[model samples]
Target chain A: MSELVHPLHRFIRPSVKYSTFCPGCGDGTVTQAILRAIDGLGMNLDDFVFVSGIGCAAWIPSPFFNADVLHTTHGRPIAFAFGIKMGLPDKKVMVVSGDGDLVAIGGNHLIQNARRNIEMVVLCINNGIYGMTGGQAAPTTPMGIRTTTTPYGTVENIFNISRLVMAAGASFVACWTAAHPKQLTNSIKKAIQKKGFAFIEVFSQCPIQFGRKTGVGSAVQMLEDYKKRSISPKEAAKLSEEELKDRIVVGELVDLEKPEMLEEVKKMKNKARGEVE
Target chain B: MNGKRVQTGRYFMMGNVACAEGALAAGCEFSAGYPITPATEVANRLAERLPQVGGAFFQMEDEISAIAAVVGASWAGKKSMTVTSGPGISLMLENIGFAIGVETPCVIVNVQRGAPTTGMPTVGVQGDMVQAKRGSHGDYEIIALCPSSPQEMFDHTVIAFNYAERYRTPVFILSDAFVGHMREEVVIPEPEKIKTEYRKIPEPGTDPQKIKGFLDEDVAPMPIFGRGFKAHVTSSCHDEYGKRNLIDISALDNFIRKLSNKILKHKEEITLIERDYEGAEIVLVSYGAVARAAAMAAAQGRKEGIPVGTLRLITVWPFPGEEIEKMARGAKHVIVLENNLGQIYPYIKAEAAHDAEVSFLPPRLVGEIQDPEDILRKIREVSK
Candidate 1:
């Protein structure tokens, strides 16, 4: 009889025999979706580079992926990926980071890279709490959510990262939960092919650190909640503000063309050399 | 023996501009910096010149991001650097530690201005001498060079890159506003004439999977990303293959020790000193722009029959303790001059204490160079 192999076996590192995620965690699901997206596009692994910052989401690519990876400092993956893209203009660079790693400390880099229309894709896993640091409240943590840092409840309003990136001028933006694996995979594939700053926020389930405190129940229950709460942008537009207040706005938020930073840089170089008008 | 210039063309240039040109000549392909006084010219010049040479230049959002970007560029197989002042250096301390942890090869130019906070924006001070060594939050050794003139600014920048690449650590060009803003004639050597060094890469067929640590006692060759090496670099305490080993005591010890010993073991080759201590009763120990005044004082002291000499430190970190010990043994007294309240004075005194008497000449509170006459007067009193 033939031996059974994992679907992502070809893309994952052989030495990383076990997943680092907690039981029933969504990180592994998101990892599989990303690998599936790359496999579907038939992209050469040699041309892909993964850049990540501190957190569990950052580990999604570091020691696991077969491709080149840079596990950088906290909240600085986008800034680091900017350098990598600038150095190797032809290579496809991608950043994987957690909500705290992206919006809390690294927000400046995210906004600036988007404003410049730098050519790279960013996948931010918004689990609503700092998982690696034991469930502290994050920027994306919802109001009234109980966390280690917010015993009574969070006082700050949650930041809608999808809307934030869209306003920051990303060429492409989308949101999906790990429950919607197929759609998440498709969105990732499109993001990979986009010419300039693409950002996708994956609303992943953090059962151990986030779910237990918020009364979100088991991992299976959280996935079910995602299925029930998610709405398409078109559907969201049709609903009243009150009706859409607590819903997860899933699907592509923005897709438009603009001059990419690195391409403009090349053009400027040519013009300076008197090769272009 | 005069070496041929790599891109030989002499030009009268500001010290900051000379530093930029020196980086270009040294094959630095990437630079990321934020604009700050005194050091802004380095970024301004690189912005105009880097793209012309097929190199990349970025004006990052802040000093923290600027240094972070340069560290990233280094791992991408580009020789990278960042230029900033004291306040900017303060913002970059954490990332500097990150670079040390990963053993990334890059250069950092700190054109220091007077500061406890934002003390003096337009004037020079050597207040950050110790900060450059201990600013980061870990036990690590860094290479720092001081330049007294535009010519040295240009020359030292090239040497800084060479040392950074050779040792796979962040090397510092610790220039001050006095030298960074000064204008002088600088000879641009031909590209071939300027010597350069690059971090060693793993052999072509070496499996990336088999690799353990990126550095050892002899400093392992750098294995960058996208070369099929799959080099796993992290800021956490890591093993030989760049894998995190948080609880493993041996792994932590090996990693931290190698990070320091790589530069410390080669202290002789890495340290650079300029001395003229023959038959001298008193010596002035100094660096950066203060060294210029110290040199003048020594010359004036000799005229007055004071028998003074100068021991100018070109490479400041690893502290050049051996050279200090030797100089102290031969002289009766050593005067340490700096633009701050004795930042490097203690180290000098510690090295020379058993052999000779060491004293400090602190900066004039009004933010002016210690006048040559003031230093000479101190020399006369100390000699007696």
Candidate 2:
């Protein structure tokens, strides 16, 4: 009998026998969801160029995926992706990074690219803490959490990353958690097809670091908590502010048709050449 | 709507504008920059001109993003560049190191102004001479060209791009505010006459597993994205196939040495010097704006019956020690002239001090070029 292989294994690098993710890490689930999204869309990996910044989530596409991947410096993958998209306007450019990488250090790039409405997908794996650096307090870390750097518990409010990108004029924006892998994959597929800046903020679980700090204890427990707190936008709208205080809003926040940067650049080039008015 | 890549005519042009023209002639498809003094003209020219020739220039949010975009564009199979000054260079050093680590080819132009930190944006100074090589915080080699005039601004930028592509590394055009803002006659050659080079890429349909696109002594063909090579490019220490190898000591060693040797091995071809040191006892070694004063001083010294010569460094980084050493061998005194307080002087001294008395002759003031009289007077003192 022939050996059984997972369908998504085809997207993994042939030389990589195992993943670098820690056991029970949500990054692995995020990785699989991304590959599944591509697989379901019947798109060749060649059609995409994946860029990631310095973080565990960044490693999802770097040495793992069997595609063109640019694993860049800390907090700069979105800036780098702007160039890649401009150079290869026909190819899809996607940026995968952690919350600390995307929201804290790389926030300017994220905001600027969203404002430009550049045609690309930025999947921010919001793990809440800096897991790779051993549970440091990230900008997205919830208040009153005792992290490595915040032993006294964080006093700062967490940033709503999806709302931030949506405010910054992204054409498409969505929020989902790791527990909702099927829906996350569906969003990824739609983001890949979007003609302007598409941002997906995935509330991922970092069981070893964040789980230990937040008393969630394990990946299953974290997922169970996510399932309990997750609410659709419709349900969220009906709830009172006090009642919806801790609930995670999970759904598309905005979807709009806008002029993209590269397409505008093309039109400018044609106009410069006197081929267009 | 004339989309000529090279405007073949003589025109009085600003140094920064000439630089933009040179980049266009060298086939630069993309550029990104932020507005900083002594360098804004380059960005302005590129923004207006690139679209006509089927290229693009993005004014990024900051210098870091500007350089990041340039490196990204290079990996996507485009010749790209970024322009800035000292303050901007400080922000770009980290990503510059990233570009070096991954062997991405791109050009960086620094229109230098006075600074320890944003001191004088409008005044020219050779303050950042050493920063171009050492600012990135790693043991690596870099190529830098020092253009003295508006004409050299046009010429050196072309060389900068060609060297960037041929070596698959970042090449710098180190122009000071004096040269960057100066207006002079620049002769633009026909597009066919301008030598342009593109980075070598793997032959079409080459197997991805077998393609060695990094850490080659001779530059490896770049495995650009969207080419079905599935090229894995990382700023981390990686193997020939662009695989991340963090555990092995030998892999780290090879990563450091190979990326450096790729430039060091071709040093003879990479170094450019204008030699006029023959039959002289006193040699004035200078580059960029100071070289103009040095050349004048040398001519005046000859008329005054002193055996004074000039060795103008056209390519300043990768240190150009051999050229300095060779020039020093034929001289009794090697005097380094610079606008700032002796940045490259120690390096020149290290190379030439063994053979001759090496000393630095700084300009009368930091922002001003060295007066020819000051250089000639220094030459007389050294000769005596």
Candidate 3:
């Protein structure tokens, strides 16, 4: 009896010190949201798997979470997670990452997975700037924003993650802000329950680098801005194109209708062998 | 070096093909990889054998996926591996780093070729020796085994898988293009005597899987899918409960430091070296095909009365330091012969210190074997 209980207490790990995130940073909130989501969903502790690339948000899962986590080289978790999922489809898999990990270094995998609709959930922690790499401008840094990498100002346009994932044909694509805890948690739950590739883009805040440079307010103020700047998903679609030019759309935008990647592969296999129509 | 019966199989094949056969006989159930030279035969052979044995074979998009797939398959309760060479190895560094970081069990075969960058694709070079130890951009330890003849290719590969599953970390059979392409007599491991282990996934399709990977210890139970438990995997540094923590210093510290310490703690079980110390004034240190030549040279030296012994490092990384150090400190001189220029000599000298006079024989001899007479002469020169 004692032996069985002894093993039960294992798997608890500590995390990294001096988070690259600033106080009131939404990435911290997003990280907690994911852990809480895992706790809430009652997913298998041993079977829980997470993978991330190099970034502030990417490090979120690195030092913590005792599940089968892999702190990979930058921007390749999607490729890494693809193997984990396909190799062991019984496990509930997730990829915790930032704009650079998901949209930049790992963008190819993101688009491909969306297109294939592999059975997994992608929690894209899109904190506006590259927080870990000393506030470099990422592909998600909005137009004209100044970052360490872009001192004058970023000339590149930002990638609206959910919109892109939806366009790429993910089976499920949802957007929420880290500040909106209830919505974020709800979307996470839905994503956990979804069969196909469920993509949830959480617009998080990095008040340290991008915020200090642009003279933005505290982490809390950034959350308020997140609340005000983004229109609800339902209303934005109903609004005119001009009304949405500066507005970010936040909601479940794509609830797709298609088979998951595994099923499709199986179908392909059966077809190749002429076992089924 | 031990006189175990080397049962020669009745099959004409390449070194890599025998390696795959050895893997199958040892009960390898899955292979995930993208094919590259010298190493491609292992992948090709698995592609044929896996289906026949009710196993699985997947040609991953690239080396990264191949290793990752093997890691995942291992977690799903299968013995797994991947094979590649040169450039593909550069890509494998990240996940290989992950395997070390997380302590997952699997085999990775790198058929070494000449390369600072594609130096020689189809050619042989042991140049990747240092890179094998320091490749993954971290301070973790590595376990690399080099095989010279086709027989060692089969034997060492089987041994590589065993070591991997035993330690639950990546073990490499660092074959060169020569060892891979050359055909020779190899004793395939009998299915009964060959040892194997699979990941500890949950029972088939039952309850919610609820154990943390790498929680209390350096190792964790594997969580395979369809075995009745839902698993969550991450690339992040995690806790004992396997939950991703955002800022746990101790967790990160323990997880990272445990890498070197774990291998060190099990040094006896992990390290392999063949030493012919005898009454020798000089020693020839080498591995893989080069070691074979060094052995012949040492034998020839004895016949000529210039007492020479050979030390073969089977486990290249986390090198057989303790033994080599003792032997070198007592030797009159040492010579390091390799296919590449001076890569491994520095390591031997570093271990032996200023005690042993050292000499190096490089790859310039190319296609031809190192002249035993020349190496013996160098040994005599160093001793004098």
Candidate 4:
């Protein structure tokens, strides 16, 4: 065996697992935050599983995570991860996919899993574009962005994932950004700690693609844009949709408590045995 | 006196329906699937039957979730199964790997319709015999059974469940569209015996309860999900404790080798290949429904002084290598037959009849069901 072990790079595993991310990519920041949160949640790396779908952000976990990471066929990480988690619920199952992956091709699974509260966590990189597939407009793409599919700027409305997830009956729901590392990490940590379904939509940066097309270059400048263009749920409650034009929303939208599914399964088994739930 | 006769021993049934009944009798509590051609009857019948037995059944929107839901129900401590045809089987490949990795016990019934892609849906075909083994993207062993009749469907479906439960592996029952759709005499057992080797439960009151997913010994330890046990389980390269380990070469290699060997070494107990030998010089090898046609051909050939014999493979996987070699001794000619273009002929060529002459006669559909005339004609051609 080679005797060289780089001590500095060794601590950054899920970090160094990705060598292809663009400099200052928000995906990389969120990726590291996820790994750090895994470290803090007392989860065994051996029981941690990650799944992804098509998109630059989806590619982040394909070869990057040191876990059983699978970059599956486009637009179905939730379905695949649903398999992994349902087949082995004791595992710390999570999915890192893109907005198009969750909302476009796999939208059916997103809401159904949340509605049933399947025991898995889904983290969406809401970069508002299908970056890896040549920057077509995505479901989360804002109304006026100039995309390859929308050269004249989009006419479709954007998706507020937090509101969507809340309406879908997710047990826990939150929103975070790469700009808020500690908060994002904590959100991920809490999501992992939850027993039922957890959904966290991260406003990730796509500097080389979505950002460049929208003239939102300079990683720091895009974040400044995020701060300026984004509004919180509380503020949004007071302001009109017209007032929120050119702005993205932030903050936890819903975090209600409900009975996790597997607990009900346990109760059924007990009931079968004539034991009181 | 009334001259009416009683058909006591058997009742006519569809192959897929029999397989469904077999699963139900064997205590299957969960049925999840999206219906496809040649397999819709099984799904439809189970939808009504499972509820009467106080079990659960759901019609998933597609095949992927159908298999996934069955896998989930299996982990939730229920015996589960799914029924589908070729197109649906293609979508189910991903979770099949997860089942192998996690050693989740479940049954997947494939009522094959013709196709490279949707060829002959309402007709019979045996095209998926190879895909049942290789379509899934991992390296693992499978226990596949092909039933020649509705009676065999009932018998083998129970066997599939038994083997799946005993070893915690995915077991497949391969039936073709003809067999799935054709109604035939099948005696419904008064009550079907469904059996699985249940995993051992965790002892109560530990701060962290331990439910073993994969065992150190060849026998996998039992695990009951949500029984208040805290087990670390995963579908990745895992240790005995079920932790996801990526590059641990020793652990992974040992697991792959052992899991294959643990069942394979006892091939005698698991393999169920039937043979007919009375100093026969010509042997006809067949499986699934074609075996019946081959058997009829062989019997007629024997009457005609051709000295023909038949080998019926009940356990399609583990391929009964030792038994085939034993039966092939002193045989002058062996003919392999199947629905596809000789999918399993190469195995016999590679292992069984390396020294003897081996010929593969590809019959394209259930319309002929492996023509006795075709085998007889091939036998004469080979003899000359």
| TM-score leader | 2
TM-score of chain A of 1: 0.97
lDDT tens per residue, model 3, B136-213: 876888788998878787888778887777667788888889999998766664456666655554444433334554
Q: Write the per-residue lDDT of candidate 2 for residues A180-252, one digit (tens) a residue.
A: 9999999999999999999999998889999987787899999898999999999999999889767899988
Q: Report the poorest 10 consecutive residues by lDDT, candidate 3 chain A.
A: A6-15
What's the residue-level lDDT of B95 in candidate 1? Answer: 91
Compose the digit string of candidate 3's lDDT tens values, residues A1-277: 4445423223334233345556767876786677666667776556567777777777666655555565566777777677677666767778888888889877877887788788888888887777876888888888888788888989987787788888888988988887777778878888887889999988887777766777776677888888888888678768897778767788888786798977765554444334211
DockQ, all models? 0.53, 0.71, 0.19, 0.12
Model 4 lDDT tens row, B1-384: 011111124667888778877887677878788868989989887765665555655676588878866766676677889899989989998778777776778999999887878777877778888888888885667888988888888888888888777777788998887778878888855442234345444465433323345734355654544443334445556666565466889978967776676567656778888789658788888898889879888888877778888888888886777677777775778888887777878877766675467888877444357777888888777766
Regions more than 4 Å wrong, model 1: A275-277, B1-7
Measured against the true structure, the TM-scores of the candidates, in listed sequence, are 0.97, 0.99, 0.79, 0.73
Worst 10 residues of 2 chain B by lDDT: B1-10
TM-score of chain A of each: 0.97, 0.97, 0.89, 0.89
Q: Which predicted model would earn the best lDDT?
A: 2
The candidate, 3 or 4, that scores higher on DockQ is: 3
Q: Any idea what lDDT model 3 has?
A: 0.74
Residue B294 in candidate 2, Cα distance off native in Å: 0.4
Which whole-number lDDT from 0 to 100 does residue B167 have in model 2? Answer: 95
Looking at model 3, give its docking quality level. incorrect
Question: Which residue pairs collide in model 4, if any?
Answer: A46-B244, A229-A247, A229-A248, A230-A248, B11-B186, B12-B184, B26-B194, B124-B178, B199-B222, B200-B222
